[model samples]
Target chain A: MSTAIRDDYLEKLIESWKKEASPVHSVSYLDQLREDALDRIESLRLPTIRDEEWRFTDISSLRSMPFPRASAAPLPGLDKQAGTFLDETACRLVFVDGQYMSGLSSLADDGSITVCSLSELIGTRASIAERYFGQLADFQENVFVALNTALMHDGVCIVIPAGVSVKVPVHILYVTSRKDVAVYPRCLLIAEPGANVTVVEEYVTLYEGASLTNAVTEMYIRDSACVNHIRVQRESSQAFHIANGSVLVAQSAHYDSVSLALGARISRFDQKIILAGGNAECEVDGLALIAGRQLADTHTFIDHANPHCRSRQLHKCIVDESAHGVFSGKIMVRPHAQQTDARQLNRNLLLSDKARMDTKPQLEIFADDVKCAHGATVGQLDNESLFYLRSRGLTEVAARNLLTYAFGGEVINRVIVPSLKQRLEEYILARTRIG
Target chain B: MINANSKVLLEVRDLHATVGGAEILKGVNLTVRSGEIHAIMGLNGSGKSTFAKVLAGHPSYEVTQGTVLFDGQDLSVLAPEERAQAGLFLAFQYPVEIPGVANDQFLRLAYNTVQGHRGKEELDPLEFDDFVREKMKLLKMNPDFLDRSVNEGFSGGEKKRNEILQMALLEPRLALLDETDSGLDIDALRIVANGVNQLSSKDNAMILVTHYQRLLDYIVPDYVHVMEAGRIIRTSGKELALALETHGYDWIHANDQATGAQP
Candidate 1:
């Protein structure tokens, strides 16, 4: 066992790294990278209640508890529970304790796409792995991100060749099977030029007790390519989850991502989409259902760096009991990014007096000739609408449930995949029951 | 069949209501006995709709000074839901579309709420399905309608018929039909009128509010009240409706002014 890691511990670690001799096998650049990460972790500070981004979500409870690093051990009793979350045709990649379990995974025999553990790729295909391993994500600036990047053991790597399209979705199931254990799971997806693919990433916890999952996903879409990404987070109520997704869109490419947040005691999702090429399009849609004393925060940034790019975002949230939900979406169009059309909308429904939701949709356009707009609304179910339903013979509870379901359903229904949409609908209905 | 001596169902004493700082109904009085249909005909802004809304406890309308007694209980003291559970139904002119609630679920909940208020046990979903099916048959509505979202994509005629179906399920002591004939075609009007006629009973009352006498032609009222401004100036039997139809509301207003009577 080791002493708990804190800010002082990070600082001490950085100080020791500056004086200690370099390891014998690793290259100079890799050693410097590790040292740089350690220095950044020492300098970067954790967000507190005073920070606006951390207003609704408090990490004090997490900081007080002792978190043990997840061991590279085989997980038992997961096969019984994993079958329900994965579809039949999905190329399932399973990971336990932040280590890929090849024996537990099932891949398509056809091999339209290459799927392997990040550690294996880093060892065998060092050049291809080195080019994108940690370029898109800036862990040094964020504490949880830095911690994950520092301790990440193994991850999932997916690559689709040029002009190739995979019909079946690739599934990455990351599960935490132990209590008081901390797992850092990473995933990197690279789609070559003119490639089309769909990826589904899910995060779940098998145990109901306390745990922590710090995960990051980086996706790179090349020229004229299309990628559909879906993320479903269903952690236990006693779990703390911090997830970050970074996407880079190339020339004339299209990127679509949908996130469903229905779990975790305290969850923070940070996503960024960079339009790096001309005539590119990006769409991000998300929904969150928070109940009990849970807190969920979703922050997104859409950076329009090129011309003739368009982006659309809509995030809906339903909060019940003493739950709190936060949404902060910012769309930025650079000065050279002319002819940009971007829109963002955030709507929230509060179901109880103790429940609260804070939404801020912001647009910062430096280009004079761009069309950008953002709007946010936080309100309860319309009284007139409720009475209207009740007058139609609905009970008060039934009327409220119907309206809430509809409010959340509007976003869920927009999912293009019929099977995924049906699953989401059933999940939402089940949550609405307790609400 | 509605019996003649079923007793009074609704009693209004100088009911006055205002909306947004403007007085709509000014000291208007009316009474409706069970088994009798009363017609309230008025031009636009004459407070006819306000009268219906006030009876249903709409929050927008403020009752300045008045008492509405429904089946021996004070209506003003009840919330909108409480008033609804008390057997008082108001068919809105523009029915609100609740996009997510199923039509059948809404109907069953409303029926059970009213039943619970009347000290009766609520029916289970199976029993309620049977109950609503019978009422749907009476309104000539398809069974598929029960599965659709409440009025989300319903036609104007369908919305009105759905309202009538709800009235049939609740079996209210008093039904206030507010502009129920608007946006309805001849066939829809006939069907709606027929449904209302079938739901009427000696132990229940009805007040039909409309601009035209066309609805009165189908659902004949025992009494007619012609309103001007915020007051009912003339009260007559079924024949006065014919007179008003033949001469228009202007003629009645002129006659009232000539006689120096307040409208």
Candidate 2:
């Protein structure tokens, strides 16, 4: 009944990591990956609030702050707020607190995509960074992804090449500079066979108090590849965001994702899509616009393992004021995944009345010639389509912000990225004119 | 021939309404002047679709006692979109469908929200696509239903000719219709009664709410009434809707509950 608490901030992070003097190239592989994340966080256990996947998300206000350990400083005027999706890019990976600035990154001038730094791909390609770092993230069953692989410094790797595609997209951005800081940022994308790419991950925050962002993204997508990922979290409302994305996809591959969680005071996003082969395709779309007292949690897993795979999930939430929205979507399939055509939809609107939405859509079909479906809906705002849009002269706050932007514009007009769907319809019409 | 100073619009009065708590319009009175059309009929719960969804501010019906007024203002303090931008219009017996919105952008946002409540100047989407292609050629509709969606997969006579092409592009001064020919078929109820008689004029006005008399034999109603258990016992003219379509509302619900009368 003892879970070792000999803490004084873990003895000042173990006497500042035994007076640091090694990392110039594998100090015993960073001391065996920080003693295997402190022996898997002192022998796995923490996940309390009655677990069921961290029931309604409670890390007791993130184990009461006190974060530190992310310092490389120099964030200075975030290069004029890193705009043109991080200025004239083809490849760009910035980071800032979770290390890797490499003088604000930029690579691909046609060497068929490699974009460095994960400590220069583990100090000069250590066997392709030991066959893909943390081999597709599990971190002994996530505790902020084992504290983001126990404070893994420097991220971004990206690969591409085999039958190349790469035309543009690749921007990575991270940010979060100090003030109660905690930034973990880790990303490793691979592609290969018949490769094609598009990735844009942007999470900001250089100031405006309180912070914590523990991110991890690992994607593979091989055979007949295609990947279009866009995660844009506009942090700092006194931040706290936890993001985890893992995708595998293989045969006849295609993996699509569009997640846009507007700011956070608390946010959780975990997306896992496996599919693993046979005509694989996964499309995930998400939009969140929570207001004051914000809390957004979106968890999705679509595994369908093999046989004629296909996965589509649409998530939309726009909870206002007393904001709180959580959507859990799962679609399994498996049994020799026959003709698996999975679909999951979660829709929520609830604009104030103490806004709240908790939608769960699950389908664990053991393929009987599968074609699974999962749906979740929590409503409000269709008082006959808000009196058919305020009898056509839209005023009740422009007909409830045009029917909550046409209910998250049916997954932001299924974004095929027209300048990120006109900057997510002008950031959801400036968050419905500040609610 | 409506024109005693050509206005009055909609009056209502003894109104009374209700839905799940039962009492469906029991004391109904009515007016609607300017270039009339009137109709009403009755039968199935004879509240004529709860007085056209309590004159279109349907919050699951519950008017519970009079006062509607209209053109001379006071519509129970507005709200069904400010009684549809103050000119009032109802249409639906079913209508809804709104999938992802576009039937010509919901009739150009209900004709620029009734031309921005009559102060005018709105049009744009290419002059609202040539003012909705001349009101979708007066309800013959189909310009590929202005790129689908609203009234979603249409048909029930293309959602009653897309509700008379949104009552001829929101030119309302009181429209109402309701069971707009419930599931039409006599050639889509004579093309949704000639697009509600070419958008009635003199200053617009109509009510209609049928139960049959074949949609007042194609919009020929200068007054019909009828209703039952919930007022309007029986008013006349348009040959009392061809005598309740050949004597039917069970002899006027047995002559108004056998003269303990209340029609």
Candidate 3:
């Protein structure tokens, strides 16, 4: 059976993929997964405004652009600027245009963890790669994820052994510098039982260029394992960024994911956490600060599949000028997932009259003995509060900026690492121009 | 104590202001002298709060015809912060709540801004914290109040005390207290009034805008004026406040009608 592709973007991407003549070592498992993803993309097609999930965010602009496929061409005389998490991390991995840059990365010789490129890992540790790759993320319904799985060539792979904890965070910097190029980057993380680790994945565009990044990440946490994942996206204002992150948590395991988006013409971050075992916990937090004509969207899902699970999520957005922001979150409690406690909140602050926000919080519970609550609020700065601050000798701009930063600070304050927290605060302050 | 011959700190002449296109203050005139604690007593809708807000240059109030001179400078030409820097302060009747900013940070920023404007050395956070703690003690405020967000989850009396605490820190030359004693209990009222009395000096002046004269008993204003229909119709010494307290504001309303005051 064959299905014809209707999506212009997919068709152009596939045509480019077929024309690739470079010799790349391929594993049978990933090849099959890629084939499956292509088939799924062909069947699903691109989502339009008719779809419920794509109602608020329009992709017509993306569909009109004929983005060229980017390869692993060496960036000549390209300079690498330090990232936000550069100072504290001993292990750092750098990627440019979806391909790993070996010269720019520094791998720690620590025995407790393993860090290598995905393509290298597929050759050296094929069994472990095959066991966990393409397991957590779903491509059947998510066209972006399917596109990423089909087109992605290489990314970062991290493995933490049992009963080991890395004191410092591992930083992965993904930089894009090509014009009108489409890039797909993938990441996979596996934490063994009793292991603990924190990872920071940052995406940035080096120059002012129009690019598309469809990234996917998968994580698996065994029993009693703890993992803190931070994803920061500060691409160019002319770029489009769409990312999907999926995590699987086992018994007594803990997973925390925080995503902060401060750039991009249009960006969307989708996060999913599956509590596969009892007594597991997950916390998902996000912040999006967009100005001018940019649009930032975030969607999160937490599934409580077993008993005694807890999930907490808080997402906030500060929009200025004519920018628009959207957030949709869902917390699901299965039939047998008794004693599940889940809460979700979304707050938005519109800085201009033309700014807009759409938020939806949903709770679907089948268990009778579960507690779940969800709320959403969209408002502008308080007039009285602004006046009060000005009365206390704060400039009008300073007063507005401070309140705006405080709105996003709720999510930033949850970070456990001090340096990262301080860096995030400064980054947010500079971006918001509060100082 | 105030001398009638002292320099005038604030002068409002023929002031007429509007809010949402409706005039609230009509031809109101008053003068505040240095070292004077004056009380403006009136009923609700008598434009008591509007008068205080207009003097603070609230954005919502538009002064159509009048001039407010502060230390002989046109107060109308200054922004709220500029007015605040030029020795003007207003303790809001309803203090705004800021949920995330700590009380200490807010106070220190205000203090530093005023200090900078005055060409004086500013205190860092550590030094300001110590100075503010001592001031808070004057209001009987707990040390924990410094760490919490400004007015967030604070009781009514606590909010009132926080407003006075700011008044003490700012040390403005012309301070306007708008119903600072309304929500406070007797004890909180005494503590807040005492704080205001301690901050009063011969170089500055205080204007207490309230509905009842009960607060005047504690602050001991040198002059008390009766405001009606957006203008001061009667002015007398502090003993007049006690007379009006015994008999409600109805007589003031009647006297205004008999004398054909502005409608």
Candidate 4:
């Protein structure tokens, strides 16, 4: 745990901020908040391997480099590169190199839904953005969130009215196309009471050079509302992606999230949820497929502050070649949160002898009348199944790849959207060499 | 069945296989010609399953000293998939549950691979579905099994039937069924035996490996071989199964010892 990496990066970041000055927004309070976030980042510094939350994942490599703020670049034929999930989405907000691309985005003019860039929202509906932004994700404890808060200039802001159920999903595509640069993308989502909506945030990079994407999303689910949040990270093989998200669920609210990681040289995602209301339900599903010198880590924390709440989490990883994966999930039941039920499971499959996985599923129950259980397992593919497939005329490689695809399909099958599921299946098949 | 013009489909000479450095098949020798069903019956731990697995090229078993010839080709040089493409099929006692792979897809892959090896035309999904449905009727398998994962969450009987369904689709020249009747009920045994009977023909051969004499009754064998300590010590006609059923395998062991044979 060396401070040299932090001091070096801190000086570079401060120098860049001095050159660019500060971002201008309609609300002066947000500018002050950004300054406060910068101060918070300075105080918190970057977490090293000594930190318990980052014990398995090392960030010294990220801190050692100088990733200046990425400038907007023209992405030719960007419209042709849109993914399969874009067609079925009701609305899509596209961003390239951390800058919003209005020409490529399809934002319908509808009064019931508010989907716009955070910068525009700051100028237009400053009051609404002022209420929800910077509320859920705590910048003081998380350095990535603090960095995103301090440096983010544009992102998506989604606000759904009360008692309305949106049938189609809304997607936000964060595409990067530069080398040796960093981008900060921030998202703020607010669902009023009884509102139901599904929001997907996808991160993909087109370039083959090393880049860093530090993103933070804050979601607020009001009383009795339902919100499904999905984060798909399919960045370039040379990219480094670090995302931090938080959800604040209100009384009887249901918040479900699925975080899928398929590419990156080094990727880490941390999501925290606070069950502040009684009878709140949260389901979190995650899947990471890493191979060939890649390291992907997922950390989640669910805090049950009220009684009669339930939380379920299932995270899986498929590691191959010299790649590594880490999963650390914790469920905390407060002293007064009686009758709380929580279950957590983490499963990993190592496809090669050189591949490795570290899993820690923890449960801290303080209440007496709570039911909590957690389990983790790491193993290779079943020998019987491999032999079975081989005996049926499949080559050894084909058998292994088929089993790997099957292992990953468990999480993809949970996606209710047929088109997204099909697209994800194709991605897995191509990556795992199933087809 | 005993004609001299019949061609030998499988020949095993002094087959000795080991798993984890422990020999399971100790000098097992067997020969089978086309158009014959030979039953290998023995007690538990007598290497019945090991022989079947070894013949099927299971990676766990190392053939320390053996030679298995399938249709005049040396089986030692081929991989498991190659052995399968060469028309050697084994019906496992416990079918594997491969989740996320539909039964129809698995069956089609196997069928196409075999067809490719034989230079036959492969069918598309819809055409194969129709063809497989007709074959499934022989085993009385429901059509829903095609959509489900291969053997995943299937009952014991259903798994056995699925194995038989695969056997029907493959149409191998030599088939080895390892304890296929162990976990099945009487009704399942009857249906499985009926399917085997329908699939048997003059152009193919079968080796039924089982512990019970009951399975032999349903699918009558031309010859019954008693395996003791991994070696076929006694070979007799089909009536030998009836004798073992009534007097048990211990009497044979006692007679072998009385005759001063190797214990």
Candidates 2 and 3 compared by TM-score, better number: 3
How close to the true structure is residue A52 of candidate 4, measured as C-alpha lDDT?
86
Scoring each candidate complex against the real one, what DockQ results?
0.34, 0.21, 0.61, 0.73
* Model 2, span A62-96: residue lDDT tens: 65665665666886556665243533355788888
Order the candidates by TM-score, highest first — what do you get?
A: 4, 3, 1, 2
Q: What's the C-alpha lDDT at position A263 in model 4? A: 83
Tens digits of per-residue lDDT for model 1 on A1-435? Answer: 133335764544334433534332343333445555655676676688888877767787776544666765786656776234455445879988788888778887787888888666545455666777677887767877776666565688888889899888888889888788788898989999999988888888888988989898999999999999988888999899998899999999999988989899999999999999999999899989999998989999999999999999989899999999999998999999999999999989999999989887888889999888888888998988877765544556766877888888767766666667777777876776623
TM-score of 4: 0.95
Candidate 3 per-residue lDDT over residues A1-435, each given as its tens digit: 254887767888787777876325577778788889988888777777788987899978888776765776666554444434467788888888888988878888866698888778655567788899998888989998998888886878899999899888888888787768888889999999989999988888877878999899899999999999988898999999999999999999999988898889999888889999999999899999999999998988899999999998889999999999999898889999999989888989999999999998889999999888889999999888888988888889888887887788778877776777788888888976865
Q: Which ten residues in a row have the lowest lDDT in candidate 4 chain B?
A: B254-263
lDDT of 4 by residue, A1-435 (tens): 122324557668756755874564445756777778777765667777899888888878876666887877877688786463466776888888788888878875667888888768655567888877898877887778888887886878888889988878888888888788888988889899999998888998887889999999989999999999888999988889999889999999999988899988999998899999999999999999999989999999999999999999989999999998999998999999999999999999998999989888888888999999899999999998999988888889888988899888888877766778888988888887756
i-RMSD of model 1 (Å, 1 decimal): 2.6
TM-score of 1: 0.82
What pairs collide in candidate 3? Answer: none
Pairs with steric clashes in candidate 4: none
Write model 2 residue lDDT over B87-188, tens digit each, in one string: 788887777676666678767876786787788888878888987888788777769888877777777889878877877777787788878888778887
Interface RMSD, prediction 4: 0.9
* TM-score per candidate, chains pooled: 0.82, 0.37, 0.90, 0.95
- The candidate with the higher DockQ, 2 or 4, is 4
> Least lDDT summed over 10 consecutive residues: which range in candidate 3 chain A?
A76-85
On TM-score, the stronger of 1 and 4 is: 4
